[model samples]
Target chain A: MNWTVRLTVNGEPHTLALDDPRVTLLDLLRERLHLSGTKKGCDRGQCGACTVLVDGRRINSCLTLALSLDGAAITTIEGLAQGDQLHPVQEAFIAHDALQCGFCTPGQIMSAVGLLNEGQAGDDPERVREGMSGNLCRCSAYVGIVEAVLDAQATLAGEKERAA
Target chain B: MNRFDYVKPATVAEAIAAAGAPGAAYLASGTNLLDLMKGNVVRPERLVDITQIKELTRIETLDNGDVRIGALVRNADLAYDASFARDFPAVAEALLSGASAQLRNAATVGGNLLQRTRCAYFYDTASACNKRAPGSGCDARDGENSQHAVLGWSDACIATNPSDFCVPLAAFDAVVEIEGSSSRREVALEALHLLPGSTPEREGVLNPGELIVAVRLPAAARGFARHARYLKVRERNSYAFAVVSAAAGLVIENGSIKQARLALGGVAAKPWRAHDAEALLAGQSAEPEVFEHAADAALREAKPSGDNAYKIPLARQLIVRALAAAAQGTPSRMPALPASPFSAVPGALHDA
Candidate 1:
């Protein structure tokens, strides 16, 4: 039996009419919606390469069924930047060389964004490393990753202060 | 994955009815269920999504101070709840320490307990796993058994329950609240999981369509709220399943150990509670010698596998060390699991 699901993917509304309920959110994103920014490294959820923010919480998209998240507001890697301007986490990643192979960058960036949104992350490097343990960098680019997160936190805090 | 109809129910009763549908399985969070489905280990014809049963997501402390944790409470939410974390640090630490933050954000308290074992043989359909296909003969029984069970393991299966939360729940002496067709009931958290006796396929004690709505943590468990510590000995420092983890809590007054609660995970098919050891610790001085005696008595029933025999001493040291830390209200650390044989001890060897 098929189900119709309404999802707000990357701030865009999508109503998927499908016949297969086994289509995971990852598949629905890449195959149906063509939002291929969310990488699928390990579909079993062991690898966080398929991470995306569902309702502002980072979750392994591969492990989530599409029908289960009807009307959910999903934020993929593609949704992070604003036109020519990159998200602070994204800018900090490049400034810090956070990626070697760039395969895990999207998920890593999304996870970092989700971490900042949760307010659990501090300017502390060790805390950032622990909080971002879900996103693995097989390339061992952790030093850069930690640096980027800290720098981004400073920039984000400044932006908030300016806004206030 | 098999073709399954998806049903999202608005109420617990409706969810139970959906579960009655042919080969129905309740899906919460889907962190565990989706993985099982992808592996073809469990093929439910219909997934009864119970996340919409809004009432089941509540986390409330009763007037009596007993805590009721709703079944759908996300692990991340529970871990970060200031009130809950302060009330049960061991339980909260265990949750945050178990899975990746992304996974914790999606995994639910109910699914954490009901998730199946991570036995390689069980997941490999080509391999013989009695738990997956009963009477198939367990391939992990004699092969790659290092991470297998060291206690309460049968010849049919040598698998360990991998939940970090269960150990602390056992220490808390929590009660599992369930809803059935006619009425509601509660089962002690220690009894919530059954040892893989002769029938390894029969994992939990829940009847068909039975729903775990919430878990009630007794107010008495607050004794450990300040002194409790959960120490997991795993392959890596973080985000790995335990090989042997101990949840220890001690209440001391006037230089005597008044009460002790201890439980071990990743060493058995179920969370092994050290009740006898805890009972013996009452009124005894919290000394290294007395703690060693308690640790030994706790592991007396341990029947180790061929390669996992190292877990016995590892678990013993962990219990003693955890108890000491709990007595002092500090964190305890141990070497990683899968260590070289005779590693928990330095410069000491031979059969005891």
Candidate 2:
């Protein structure tokens, strides 16, 4: 069944002609909208490689049907930066050496942003480890990833406080 | 993925009508259902989208203090609600402990209630999984049976119900409000999930078109939640299915256990509530020895497969640990390691 789904990707509005009702949100973003920053690792919920923020909540995009979210706002890894500048999470990832092959980095950053938004990004390493357990790095760069999330969380908090 | 037609139902009647199709399945959160669809485990020709039914998304409390949680309530919403957290902290903890934050955010209460087993053999399409295909034979019975059932398992299938919320709901004696098109009925939460006896394909007794509207937990659980705990032990510290989980609640008065409720997972086809064990706890003081007795009683009927015999002793100690923590009102406690009772069993040497 073909359906037209209107979605707000990043900041711009898009109306995708979904020919297949079985198309996943990840496929819709990557194939239809050409937002390939979101990689597909397991093609299932096991890996966090397809993580994206739908209405400010991190979800496995591969497991979400695109047609189900008709008017939802989706934030992908491509939407994280502003004019060649990286998001605080992306900057923290580069500073802390949180990636090796960089396949899971985008999902990791998106999940980290979502976790911080949910107030789960604590300064404690153990708490961060538990909060970021969903995003797995095959390169075993967890120590650096944990450090980066904590640093990005502090930076995000500072930016919020300064703005306020 | 196979092509499927989808319809967004606006009301409960429309949802029921849409779901009345032989090849129709209701899509609430699409967390597990979509995974299964992509895996080719379940192929539905049509999907009845019930998320548009706004009334099913509410969570409220009755005038009598019973909690009525809508089926469409997302796991994260119920897990993080301040009022629910303050009232039923154990239920909140149970919801939080099941899946990752990303999954919890997308998983609805109805999806969690009807979540499929995570058995390795059942997921592998090439393998013979009776749950997936009737009369296909269960390969997990003799192959890679480390996580298979140790209780309430028949030769047909040994897959356990992979639900953390169900453990506490069984202990709370929650009532499921089934909303049919023309009739409404109530089924106890414990009875909602059936044992996989002969038909592993049939997980629950809900009619095809009937929708689970809400789960109503009695007012007793509100008071009982103060002393309840849901302890889950898994292969990893997080993001793994339970190796053996126990939900326990005890009402102690004057240093003696007046009432007790116990439910176990990862060791049974359904959430195994130990009635005999709870009966033994009444009028007894909450002590390590008493907890051990209850644990022993719970595992007395356990029939473990050769490779997974370790689950027997492992589950017994978990029950003891969970009960001990509940009796003491401890928020967190480590499960005590006991010597494996099945160390002598053949092919179970890894547990020794």
Candidate 3:
């Protein structure tokens, strides 16, 4: 049986007819929608390589069934960068040299954005490290990742203050 | 993952009816269910998606002062709720201590209560697991069983419940509300999970189509808010299951204990409430000696199931440490790392 689901990805709405209910959101994004910014690693929800923002909350997309989500807003790594400009987190990742293999970069960036939005970690480096413990980097780029997240948080905070 | 029939039920009655068929399972966020399906550990012929049921997403305090948490409420939501966290700090700490932030945001409270054991043998489909296959031989009994249960184990199977949230809930005497096809009933959260007897397959007390609608915390549970803590010892600093975890709550007046509640996790098939220990602690002056005796009483019946004799002593020490921390009083805010031993009050390492 086909299940129809409506989702707003990065701001663009798409109504998809899922042929199989077993298709996860990660697969739907990479395969059907052709938006492959989200990577699937250890798809059993252990690894956070498939992290994405669902309705403004970071969640593992691989464990979430596409059919279970209807009228939900999804934000993937591909959605973070504008036409020529990158999101603050993406820019900070490059500035801090947070990527060695660039495999887990998108997921790390998305998770950092979501963490900043949650506003729990603040400027505490230990809290940032604990908050980002879910996403693993096989290349051991954790030091750079932690630096990148903190920098991005400061940038976002400064932007909000100036706007206010 | 298997391609099963997807049925989105709009109401509790409809969800029950859809799940009444054999080989049918209820799907909330599909955090654990989808993982099991992908691993071929569980193969349901149909999945009744209950996420769209708006009623089950609420977290409200009833007029009687009882906090009713909807089954579908996300773990992160409950932990971050200001009032709920203020009332049940230990529970919030325990919730944050479990799985990563991403998983906690997606996983529901009901799903956490029903998650399967993390035994490697149980996850490996090639191995024989009595809990997975009813008549299958138990491979975890003698094969790499360092993480097996230390208490409440029969000859049939040996496994421990892995939920950190259930530890504090068990201590606070949480109640689980169930919705069956024909009627609704309630059961204590402690009794919801069954020990591995001859039938290790029956993990929970729910019938085939019965659904966990909500979890209710009694008003009296709030009394422990001032002096409550959940401490977990894990292999990693974070994002890991507890080797031996404990939740301790105390009510002190005039520098004497008025009431006490204690529960241990990663030690038994269910959240083991230390009733004897609580009884021993009542009316006693808060001291190191008193906490040690309570720990002994709590672990009096604990015995190693396999190669996990180390768990017994570890649990005993954790119980004592948790009680001592509770007596010291809960922190004004949650520790940065939730329940980790590393997250304990700074400069207090001398206590350990």
Interface root-mean-square deviation, each candidate: 5.3, 5.5, 1.8
**Considering just chain B, what TM-score does every model have?**
0.93, 0.92, 0.97
Angstrom error of the Cα, residue B184, model 3: value is: 0.3
Which candidate do you rate higher for DockQ, 1 or 3? Answer: 3
Judge the docking of candidate 2 as incorrect, acceptable, medium or high.
medium
Alpha-carbon lDDT, every model: 0.86, 0.84, 0.91
lDDT of candidate 3? 0.91
lDDT of 3 at B201: 88
After superposition, candidate 2 runs with Cα above 4 Å error? B330-352
User: Between which residue pairs do clashes occur in model 3?
Assistant: none
Q: Cα deviation in Å at residue B43, candidate 3?
A: 0.6
lDDT of 2 by residue, B147-184 (tens): 88898788899888888888888887889999787899
- Model 3 earns a TM-score of 0.98
Best by lDDT: 3
Every model's DockQ, to 2 decimals?
0.53, 0.54, 0.73
In the predicted model 2, the residue pairs found to clash are: none
Report the CAPRI category for model 3. Answer: medium
* Cα distance off (Å), candidate 3, residue A131: 0.8
Cα-lDDT of candidate 1 = 0.86
